[model samples]
Target: MGLRLACRPLKPIDARRAREYAKHAMPSVHLTRHLYTFFPHLEGQHLIVEASTAGEVVAALEKLAPGIGFYICDERGRLRTHVNIFVGKQMIRDRKGLTDAVAADDEVHILQALSGG
Candidate 1:
């Protein structure tokens, strides 16, 4: 089952608003046709994936924020540029691929990298 992502710390956004946005932001099924065919279980709302593993959680978060500072990788093994993902004490640089194992109690964090003049 997918998660009802809590939005307590989502700044200007709340859970209901965030969920609605996520529903609308879902990528077209065609875009991920090839991959979903193989991982069919990931076809739809699976976008809001939840796991006891920190690695799994980070990977899911990256997909939700595929942009600069949001390192998301498709199943094709291509890393989305400009994004960075971190899990607790570790920083992830491998976007094209990652297999880090996660535990149920581990916390997953997703955020954009900041640059200043």
Candidate 2:
């Protein structure tokens, strides 16, 4: 099965770019070999990656793309401060953490980290 990822309602960048990076985003196997075992199977857009259960997500992200910030949606469906992510059916509380377990056929939502008043 393939995972459908999606990252929308963003702030600065467009959805295409978001999907592009996510689609090809791969962590450095040198640092975390375990990630290569699972990430290689992940491809395409429409998949959402929320930091709710899997710690590997964060680790992989840091390795794939650094100096860039991801988003984490809050309970109210609104982007929170310093947080923007979601798992299968849960919102990520850890702004800098990924504890959600992502299945091979699950959708990974990478919400745009919203800011401003």
Candidate 3:
């Protein structure tokens, strides 16, 4: 099941209600434990997101947790070098634009790669 919010024009959303609505309706995002340390509020959240594309999923998550999108994606909105997002068991193909398709029931996993000696 999917519901599309009526998108407004290019106007910035300064309205609090609109933001709250998005938050209330947002699907819980499941990330790696490493990420949970950064956003403790997201710990143990479900792994579902409602969106057609991987990009939209990221956008929805950005609405829920501020700065999360940037942590997963670069300023240009491309997947970061150390971040990995999978639509399911398969990794996304379009890392640059995150245009990979995602169904409503699909589980999106976002993980940050750990590097150490």
Candidate 4:
């Protein structure tokens, strides 16, 4: 499913508000890698996408590799425990909701978190 934003004529005040909103919105984000085990076809390639949120970025990735999202996340749309997603230097706070904010220059890294006994 996709979301379509309806275009409408804006009044002077609304237009100003829209401009302000656009200023805060990031234009794009970079995906460093798509973990080989999960996305073999896109393993080494770095993908640049236009998305404001982490979820949107994953959705864009799904377009490139079908069922990719399922591998990274569960049926409830939560990030798997073994999967680690970082937007820039900090790890995302809401793993389950994926409501983390992402910027245009931010590097989004998705990789498997390894552990040993």
Candidate 4 structure lDDT? 0.75
Predicted candidate 1: what Cα RMSD to the true structure? 15.1
Candidate 4 versus the native: TM-score?
A: 0.66
Q: Candidate 3, residues 4-110: lDDT per residue as tens digits? A: 89977897767897767665553335688887777788776664566888899888887778888889999899999998888778899899999998765567888
- How far in Å is the alpha carbon of 22 misplaced in model 1? 29
Counted clashes in each candidate structure: 8, 27, 0, 0
Q: What is each predicted model's overall lDDT from 0 to 1?
A: 0.45, 0.45, 0.80, 0.75
Maximum-TM-score candidate: 3
Error of 3 at 66 (Å): 0.4
Compute the lDDT of residue 6 as modeled in candidate 3: 97
| Pairs in clash, predicted candidate 4 | none
lDDT of 4 at 51: 74
The runs of at least 3 residues in candidate 1 whose Cα sits more than 4 Å from the true structure, single-residue gaps closed, are 1-49, 52-55, 58-71, 74-77, 115-117
Q: What are the RMSDs of all candidates, in order?
A: 15.1, 17.3, 12.9, 13.1
**Candidates ranked, most accurate by lDDT first:** 3, 4, 1, 2
Q: All candidates' TM-scores?
A: 0.35, 0.36, 0.72, 0.66
- lDDT (C-alpha) at residue 41 in model 4: 76
